[model samples]
Target: MEYVPVWIAIGLVIGVVGKLAMPGRDPGGFIVTILLGIAGALLAGFACRAADIGGDGGLAIHGAAAVGAAVLLILYRLVMWSRTR
Candidate 1:
């Protein structure tokens, strides 16, 4: 079996961890959470590469990306809440 890329693995971890970090009523289910985490990882990768803040083997980049993803998800939930009210 082929191993998943480090970046992908990192992204998945970030996504799962990030979601867990955020508390509250999140719309959707487990799949949604997984998607959010993976999406966050991807976003983090792109952001880091674009800003040239990657490749240092530091947790900062990964953490930042997770935070970013969580922030986006929270915003999404808030918007949804507003629209429903």
Candidate 2:
């Protein structure tokens, strides 16, 4: 409830970082970026919660989130490439 904004901020940061970290140009626009970030954050939060990596801090931006975002970006690229080829 109260953590919605936090999650959005975290997502935005993670998404931007993920996009920047990835090599070469990626597709999509602002909405896609936002969605990617939100999804990445959610994935990381869930994984961390399941693995108990960050204690009980709920969903926040951290190493796991960054990694998750990167992973998502990589997967996105792979899928896009596969579709093109």
Compose the digit string of candidate 1's lDDT tens values, residues 8-53. 5665675566567765565665567667666766676667766877
Would you estimate the TM-scores of all the predictions?
0.62, 0.65
> For residues 1-75, could you state the per-residue lDDT of candidate 2 as single tens digits?
344456567778866766666545456755576678878767876677677777756434366665676677667
Score residue 78 of candidate 2 by CA lDDT: 81
Give candidate 2 regions above 4 Å deviation.
1-4, 20-27, 58-61
Error in Å for residue 22 of model 1: 6.9
Give the lDDT of residue 55 in candidate 1: 65
Which candidate should be chosen as best, given lDDT against the real structure?
Answer: 2
- Estimate the overall C-alpha local distance difference test score of candidate 2: 0.67
Question: lDDT of each prediction vs. the true structure?
Answer: 0.62, 0.67
Q: Measured by C-alpha RMSD in angstroms, how accurate is candidate 1?
A: 4.1
